[model samples]
Target: MIGGKGEQKTLRLVARHADIWHSFVRPHELPHKLDVIERWAEREQRDTSGLVISNELGHRGEDHADDLYDAGVRLFTLAFHGPDWDYDLVRRWLRWRDAKNA
Candidate 1:
């Protein structure tokens, strides 16, 4: 999974090099970006449905989590800054994840 993003070249790279992308894009932007990626994938005869999606929890937390999930994100990275961490958020997501995976 490519856990990052960049400019136009980023999409080109994602099209040519990635099978899964962990975009730095905000939740609202994911669909469009995914569409862009899908178009590229299409040009290469790649099946868009086979691509996996991911995001960093720091982007928006659970507020956008479910939507991201619904939009095809299967992986999520929780970025913790330092000493303090939000295990509660993790737990909640874990619950949702486990159930989803189940």
Candidate 2:
């Protein structure tokens, strides 16, 4: 659900063109949304198997970050909406990623 209220339109476009799908949702909500997306993908016989799921690291915090990661969300987005941004968590996450990949 990247675009407007047009769910079908968004899913359709994602089915064809999206390498990844980004959304702002709770960890508990991921499966249901993926189910909806899968249903929609099935309509067009579109496979979302190759699509990576992503989310923002807002109030989600560290625990939720781990939760989302376990739920298959590998890409986490952090907004730098400031004159001075904190790189601590980002660096730690990168290191974690490296260790995981290694």
Candidate 3:
């Protein structure tokens, strides 16, 4: 779900058939997109509580983890490119995950 039309179409199927929805929307857009999913789920008589929301995190997303988490994103896929990958983000997120679980 990337473009507006594609996202909308995907969301409809997500509501009816998906147990997980992975979104590329930014942190600010998460709530609204989630609301749309909820509405579609309601239209289909589906409960979204069991629906897992996943988001991808690049360097730009490091600062917004809390915001996304608060918005109900439970799964995060971290992206690292290039031949030399920096593990700092990985360490940071691991620490954050530990603290959250603790």
TM-score winner among the candidates? 3
lDDT for 29 in candidate 3 is 90
Worst 10 residues of 1 by lDDT: 1-10
For 1-102, candidate 3 gives per-residue lDDT tens digits of 222214468888888888878887777897788788888888999987888888877765545887888778788778877688778878888887787678
Clashing pairs in 1: none
Q: List the residue pairs that clash in candidate 2.
A: none
Best lDDT among the predictions, by candidate number:
3
Scored by CA lDDT, what does every candidate get? 0.74, 0.72, 0.76
What's the CA error at residue 1 for candidate 1, in Å?
A: 2.8
Better of 2 and 3 by lDDT: 3
The candidate with the higher TM-score, 1 or 2, is: 2
Note each model's CA RMSD in angstroms: 2.5, 2.7, 2.8
The TM-score measured for candidate 1 stands at: 0.75
lDDT of 1 by residue, 1-102 (tens): 555666367776777777778886776788888888877777777666777787776647565887788777888788666578777777777887798789
The worst-scoring run of ten residues by lDDT in candidate 2 lies at 1-10
Model 3 is weakest, by summed lDDT over 10 consecutive residues, at: 1-10
Candidate 1 residue runs with Cα over 4 Å from true position: 84-86
